[model samples]
Target chain A: MFDLKPYLEVQRQRVDASLKSYLGPEDASNSRVTQAMAYSVMAGGKRLRPILCIAGAQAVGGDHEAVTALACALEMVHTYSLIHDDLPAMDDDEKRRGKFTCHVQFDEATAILAGDALLTLAFEILATTASQCQAAEHPKWLRAIGKIASAAGCNGMIEGQMRDIAFEGTVISIEQLEALHGLKTGKLIQASVVSGGMVAGASEIQLQALGAYAAHIGLAFQVADDILNVTGDPERLGKATGTDQARGKNTYPLLIGLASSQHLAGQLVDKALNALAAFDKKADPLRAIARYVVERNR
Target chain B: MFDLKPYLEVQRQRVDASLKSYLGPEDASNSRVTQAMAYSVMAGGKRLRPILCIAGAQAVGGDHEAVTALACALEMVHTYSLIHDDLPAMDDDEKRRGKFTCHVQFDEATAILAGDALLTLAFEILATTASQCQAAEHPKWLRAIGKIASAAGCNGMIEGQMRDIAFEGTVISIEQLEALHGLKTGKLIQASVVSGGMVAGASEIQLQALGAYAAHIGLAFQVADDILNVTGDPERLGKATGTDQARGKNTYPLLIGLASSQHLAGQLVDKALNALAAFDKKADPLRAIARYVVERNR
Candidate 1:
């Protein structure tokens, strides 16, 4: 009976509103760099990570406001990553989310500054938000921020990106593909769920369970993305389809075959659901997310 | 006659030693991304910012170890900035500290990841360090991290870089130059001093004084660089002479004559010294740093 459409919409709205406030106004005294930052952050997207963060926080009885700053912080990091990814030196995409990429919309210099600004802003938000929270909760907030930072940084997603670039035009083993996906995409998603649980004061057992759920879903999400890239509609995906194959980039389907990829994705979804078995009925939303991860077309 | 050479050597060694330990071991389990990060971070530099951080902490009766994490964090940020600044899209410098820059040494992709990793590691260090600190000090630590984050991010140094890029080859007013330098260089230096004071539980007045001292010295440091780029020995400077002019970038010597630039730098050093007058004799090192800023040939 659970409908992901409405749930996703509500969460997206909440995250979007918060992000709008988090970016604030463009001051006249502000330089073009600041303005570029605002434009890039305000550019519309699904707000999946921030919404996941809020949902994760709420799932554990945490207050929305307690994690609001972190939600914004996560989005900033995500946006910065996207900006850098789109640079002429990287993926060099001219468009994202149906709009011009940061570097393309503004200049390359502005894009770099905007991305750097957003990354720094994320940490600032985490630090300031930690101070505003209760003394007992400060450590938890700090840990959450640390996890997010690491996931976005070199040891995690960025490293994965390096591997992806290096492996371009070459066939990668399934294990290598999994490792790349885990670092590139899984860490941030894991951080999103774990951060929420930390803020809500979830027990250690519960935290571990949530991490399992996140890991499974994170993998499932990537598999689904790979599937969509191969089969999804261009209008719905908001990006060019078949580019992954055309670019000779390794993907789940490429390494394991489409049927095997789908089977693997299903197994991940099952694992995600099983991980949530310990949670009370309140975790139903999370279960729905796991299912949606593999089932969604885009 | 206090000589900073020995102290500088000692501090650089300490920072270098700590950096090696902080980077952790390189292994198969450790991704190539992290290896690249270790390469860039372990690459040699003077460790001036970290030394300044430790000095700032010591000025307020805090042990260097108490601020070591922050010191490492500052160096990570500084290193990341340099890596990005040397990208083909940016300053495009092939050399730094007399060696091939990160992008030139490694692939551009690896270099980018290395920078990302270093920046992320900085926050992780702060977060983990803060968690290990006394509970009562958590708020202070978080605040310090937040200040550093803000200074590094969009509203600060990155924005300054954007303005600097935009104003290249264009005549900039002195006030505009001050604003740019303040954000680009002054903010991080200010954060270093303020963070040290915060860790030491300095009074609000003391914190303000420290900030003033750092700001003056920061500007003075840039002015000295401008002067040196024009006047210093090429061998000692370790880079091309008059490159600023070659690139058509504005500088203190370019805007106000060399004599005026020297006089202005002297005035700023005096202002920096005056700001430290509120502190007792413990502030001698800081005063010495201000003098060194003006007097150093390299």
Candidate 2:
């Protein structure tokens, strides 16, 4: 065993610290929007996207410092999505990570502005980072930014969210459900991994391999999420169970049965691991992460 | 004297066509969110920001084609801000540009998503444009992106929106009102002009002049807006008049008398025109636009 537990703990702690530093300290002079942004982002999650970003960079022999800004940007985008998704107009979620959601803590208007601020800040960070780099490396950062934006933009996560909203309370085929999840969740995950590689100057072949690995793990991650929604402890999950079912939202388990969903997740994890066979121990975190994606309780 | 009417009309049409092209064609496969986005973006407006961007580039001897994507990106960002500002949780407005607001035409959730999609797309276009540019010009594009992002990010438009909402129904000082609008509206407008100059490789001195010019015009524009809110025709303005008074929102005319506010706007426009002293006929449009900002009925 590669001791994935300790590895995850260390990476999560590092990302958490970097995120706090990147967001900077909050004084009384800080606006309510900034406070809300800090509150939501610091409210704690698995930090999965940022951790994957770091791992992707590391797999190509890049250092943690090299991807710190990029990782923080990814986390900011993820946090913004959560804030907006939890709004009254969307999921109407009152709590997340066992804390009051942004809109619940602040007003709905503040929450919306906070989400907008975070999304804009993500690009600010990206553009600032690219500007700071040497001219030779500027293209890499720009390419990574493009990847992240596409993953978050109309044809990717946003479109997926639209479809998800439209499909609510209605049944769709398994393929459609998979495609939806692929857009909503899988694309960002794929971007996280591939962008890290891109910033690290990964070869085209390596980038393709990382993309393949991420695609598998991304779907597996969502499938595990569906399973957790039905079977996990609410306390551990920091949210109520069966939200998808209650909303009449489509899920892998809902369409394919729980057993098949679990099997499919396991198989995806295996495929993800296989996609990383060319890399040495440097890719251990990615490999361990794929396993953790399916096997973790929450 | 410069014939600003024909100039403005021609530039507006060019920007309108470019915006349509940038957004691309809508088809049956498009999601409802996309439809809502198109519906709101295609609604009638002055197209001021994009025009300023194009003018800024031209002032630096850059052709229209050179800054087309950037101009479209600025318009998209401006449109996204308008959409969000009209949301029920924010302005709660029912109409904008003589049409039903995004939240009114579509649902609140769809409107929110459309705004988000447009914001994300703006950055996508910026990053893609930077990526497509020659390596020699890449730094300038990245710099422009940094400037735009900072103008639109936490300490910029979003914070301004937060403060605006917080100040609703509460009287504030003149300085506070000016500061609020400076961030909320002035910053993006400044970025529009400066980013255009930047993409066209304006010298540092030229950029500073453009910045000064934009700052003066930006504040003048808002002062004029306050005057219009108090005095303009409801049908001409698209939305109702006296909305500032209805919301108890602070305005120039509220802080000072209407005649004094008008005087202040003319002074600011004069300052804006004086800021362009170094430029020749190429800067005529900017000078004319500054006058238009204060003189327009709408």
Candidate 3:
């Protein structure tokens, strides 16, 4: 079995160091907004999306250094979403990743601006970073950036939140629930994986396989999230566990029961791993990630 | 001496027709969020940024079709800013463009999501549209996108917004207020003009001239806005007069009296016109726009 922990940590440390440079200064002038942005990012999550981007690139024999920018961009998008999702207008949460949420720490308007800034910064990073690449790769940069945008845009994650809001407290079909999760959490995860592959200059066959792998793993990650929401330790999870059920949220566990949700996550992981069969040991991280998604304590 | 009304109208109609297509469908599943996004964009405004983009490209001899994507992208960013700025947590405005604000028409959460969606869609349009361009233009696309992102990101509009919020009900000097508006409103306006120029592969000299022109017009536009807030007819202005005073918001008229403010606006316009000395009638739109900015009723 591959020891994925150290690999994840190594990338985590690297991203953490560079993310600050990309963020520029929290100067005395714009300190409040910059502080909120840095606070939210540095509060810490698994950095899962970025690590996935790196692994995907590695699996395709691509340069990890070249893909670092894309990985950071993905993480920024995830960070922005979390900040917005925790706002008084959305989930109304006061804490995130073991710290006061952006709105709670800074004022609400500052939080909103911080989220806006972070989201805008993601594209800025992608565009500027791509400029450093050879002229031949410019089209790929545009395509990759577009994919990231769509995954996070109206028809993707935002729409999923809209549907969730519309469907809250109601029993939704497995398909409806699946589709909702697929958009909310799954799409970005898929984007994270596929973005890495694209940066690595993936061939059509490799891209397809990566897509399949991403699709399966994305759902598994969400399913596991739902399960953790119900049963995981709040301390480890860095959030209260029962809010989903309390809010009558539409989730895999809520729709099909916790046991079934767990089983579904397992099945999805199996599919995710199978999709990577064509790759040799080079894809060990991808395989390990799928398993870890269902097995993570947090 | 150019008649800008007809020229502005022609581009407005073209952009309005295509803007809807960029927003995608108000699908039944995500109708609430999609509706909010559509409603916000469709609500009438000058579409100044988009027109600036088109004018910038035209002045540099670029293809209109190629730059239309960027034109729409600028509009979307503008729309998103308006939506967020009106939220209860931000400007807390009840109305905009003589209509109920997005939060008023569609709850705070939906409004928030709509703003986020619009922002994301801008990048999506840039990426996807740039994909259709010739390979040689790919780097230009990245540069253009990066410029847009920087103009709108934390160091730009959002940071400016942060300052505006912090400075509300507090006094600020002319220089401070100028710097604030320069970032808040001016950067994106500058980006709008420059993005079109970049798409057309502007020579460095032409780009610098456009920059100087944009800088002047941007400040002149804001100065005119401050004058109008205190003096213009309420109906023509769309929003109420003296709200800036009511809110203690800083403005040129407040800082330096209406007469001086108007004088400053004219001077800026003259400077903007002077910046175009190197270009011929190809920049007629740019010249006309500077005049219109300080002269328009609203």
| Candidate numbers sorted by DockQ from highest down | 3, 2, 1
The better-scoring model by DockQ among 2 and 3 is 3
> What lDDT tens digits, residue by residue, belong to model 2 across residues A1-298?
6888888798889888977876765555667788888889899998899889989998999855758889889999999998999999998999999999999999899899889888899998889888888899888988998899889988889888888888999999999988998899899999999999999989999999999999999999999999999998998788899988888989988999999999999999999999999998989999999999988843
Scored against the true structure, residue A138 in model 2 reaches a CA lDDT of 89
lDDT of 1 by residue, B132-241 (tens): 88899898899999899989987677877777887889989899999999988889989888887788777888889999999999999999999999998878766777
True contacts kept of each: 0.93, 0.73, 0.97
lDDT string, candidate 3, A1-298, tens digits: 8998898898898888778777755555437888888888878899999989888888898856768889888989999999998898888889988889999988899888889999999999999988998988887778889999999987889988888888887878989988987899888988888889997899879888888999999988888888998899998888889888889887887778888888888999999998999998888999998889998834
Per-model TM-score (chain A alone) = 0.95, 0.97, 0.96
Off by over 4 Å in 1: A25-30, B1-3, B24-32
Task: List RMSD in Å for every model shown.
Answer: 2.0, 1.5, 1.6
Best by DockQ: 3
Candidate 1 vs candidate 2: the TM-score winner is: 2
> Predicted chain A of model 3: TM-score relative to the true chain A?
0.96
Error of 1 at A190 (Å): 0.4
